[model samples]
Target: MASYKYDIASGAEAFTFNSVMRACTKEVAALSWCMQHGLIAAKAVCSRCAPPPFMRRKGMHWRCSRSSCRVERSVRMNSFVERSTAPISKLVMVIFFWASGTHVTEAAQHAEVGGDGNVVEIDATSMTKKQKYNRGKKHADY
Candidate 1:
């Protein structure tokens, strides 16, 4: 028997790679989805306050609602998105492809070959024209 560090499914999201990828198609959607997955921080804190506390959002960015200390916080503060330059949709699509049992190299290839890298298109085709995706393990070249 082998020991595993993680389960096949994270929670209620059974076989949810497709759904998660779909959810991250937009900026706001990506933020919310990442927050739900614990991949990014959803809330912000006031920096001007003496003790510093959680802040409320005025719009796209968070702001200290207190009239005396109305400091604004960038949406990317302390979040993974702050450092990443890649498009959120591409990241989500790659993650989905990876979670769906596709290798990183294969995922890249799939993305290039299949516009937007949707799972259906990626899964529907194979790298080599000779070896079909679902037919067998032996590659055509081998």
Candidate 2:
């Protein structure tokens, strides 16, 4: 399991959902929250440079500190949100809603996946199944 900054043992009820929602309202705040929650790397190393120079945040990307190397990478690189096309705020809200066991339609509405007229169908059977006896792989070995 991933290490969360908050005490997840207390369950989703104890999670400060409102505070998280507020924090994620802005791009910068969402970035900060993601970093704090280990969703994004706070610091990154440049792969192009030998001995890997530390990368610093420059706008939406991380630039290498070494003047000679000058490598650049997206802030979302190697993170859960890396491939996501949605805004960070929406993604954060969706994740929180899912964690809190909110209904699929409610979560989708909150995340803005579908507008007032659009339909969002959720097939629960398509979701990953629980491991049986914790002995087999979660997915079928095809």
TM-scores of all models? 0.55, 0.65
lDDT of 1 by residue, 1-142 (tens): 9987976565857237566656756767776677677766677778779787788865447888778888887666686567667766566677678667888777776455444544443254555656466676666553
lDDT of 2 by residue, 1-142 (tens): 8976976567444247777778777988888888877888999999998888789999789999999888889998999999998778778887888787899987765566768788889875655665777667766732
Off by over 4 Å in 2: 1-14, 108-142
Clashes of each: 0, 0
Query: Alpha carbon lDDT of residue 31, candidate 2?
Result: 84
- Model 2 worst lDDT run, 10 consecutive residues: 6-15
Say what the RMSD of model 1 is: 14.8
Candidate 2 whole-model C-alpha lDDT, 0 to 1: 0.80
